[model samples]
Target: MFGKSLKVFGILLLCISFTGCAKARYAAPEPETRVVGGASRAEAFRFTPSGDQAWLSWEQKPTDEEYGSFILKIGRANFADGSPLPLDTAVGVEVVLWMPAMGHGSNPVALEKIDIGTYRVSEVFFTMPGDWEIRVRRTTEAYGVEETALAIRI
Candidate 1:
């Protein structure tokens, strides 16, 4: 009887020791922000600029090394009352690729206006592969700096 109790105690002690000596675990760091204003998690490939009247979308990313890295984007904007922006608004757009984990950004991208509301983003080079934020900005005298950002894992 004593031997049985001792065996049970030994098993319990062994289990307790194994559990008590477990190594501490750590988790990967989370992205500081989801998008633009840095609020809740954003899962958007399309976003609205600061003016809250413009919508933007990005396409053709994750470029290969052999081919030049570039991104294509499109936008549509309207006034406060939802009227489309005038043709003479003279809007300009730019793209900036930033890696938040490393606190660094890629080379300045070349912006080519494809049409009234479309652009071909070029020269977007990334040093390392990690989570990146693609910041898109549209500027006009009336809207000032209408900007938006989207987080993506590359």
Candidate 2:
């Protein structure tokens, strides 16, 4: 009886150890929203009128709808104190790219969907600007409408 009890205890210990290991190996995948906006989610580009042109780039996160729509709006502002201008008074602007059925909505340029969570390059031009705000309005099937804004100095 003693030997049988000892064997049962050892088996129980081994089962417990295996269960713990399995639990340790299991990890939930990071959410899509968190991954897309990793570091530059809210980051804005800064420019100083180099050669009368500046390159703008940003990341956009999409939902799991296979297809979605978004609107990109670029705003130009004349700042005196080096501060970012308000969203309401952004004038003298240009629409670099406008695409439909793509990840980004109406604009001047077309952005092709590269992968499930990535988008192609969308470029814009700033003509002698003091401050420019690059705004993206994304509409997903799951998350409705989301906005991402970036400010650049030129």
Candidate 3:
């Protein structure tokens, strides 16, 4: 009986140590930000049967004065309300397509100078019917970052 009790206690201590180690490994880190901005100017879009599209546009200001150039990073998520949902928790959330204007493009088609002020952007399209979220992350020349979120249903 004494030997059996000692073995059980040893097993319990090993399990507790392993649990602590696993918790440390599975911890999530916080996000890091360089320069902060007021809000991002983003637009959401959806297509009609005749190939027509809709857009929800907004205006934004630079986070810092050193912002010389800017590029928009767009991503899509599926939610009814435009709330920040975890990517892993959300269902049907996928990046349909993304376009980076200026230096934003991974494979830039062409470079064009955007007028420094409020401007109208091109219409984004949704291929099929579902909930979608469009997020835009703008990076400036001075390393300033700004982001905005928009939700859409098709």
Top candidate when judged by lDDT against the true structure:
1
Global lDDT for candidate 2?
0.37
Model 2 superposed RMSD (Cα) = 17.4
Cα RMSD (angstroms) for every candidate in the order listed: 11.2, 17.4, 17.0
Assess candidate 3 and give its TM-score to the true structure: 0.27
Q: What is the lDDT of residue 136 in candidate 2?
A: 46
The global Cα lDDT (0 to 1) of model 3 is 0.34
Q: For model 1, how does the per-residue alpha-carbon lDDT over 1-154 read when each residue is reduced to its tens digit?
A: 9999999999999999998887656543333443222322212343333333333333433354622333344433444644334233436677888887788898777778766654567666666666787787667677676666666655
Q: After the best TM-score superposition of candidate 3, give how far the Cα of residue 13 lies from its true spot, in angstroms.
A: 24
Question: How would you encode candidate 2's per-residue C-alpha lDDT over 34-115 as one tens digit per residue?
Answer: 2222444233322222111112334443333322223322223335643233232221233332222233432244455443
Checking candidate 1 for backbone clashes, the offending pairs are: none
lDDT of all predictions? 0.56, 0.37, 0.34
TM-score of each: 0.51, 0.31, 0.27
**Model 3 bad stretches (over 4 Å):** 1-55, 58-115, 141-143
lDDT by residue (tens digit), candidate 3, 18-98: 887764654543222212232444334322121212223333222222212233322232358642221111111122122
List, in order, the clash count of every candidate structure: 0, 7, 1
Candidate 2 ranges with C-alpha deviation above 4 Å:
1-107
lDDT, candidate 1, at 66? 27
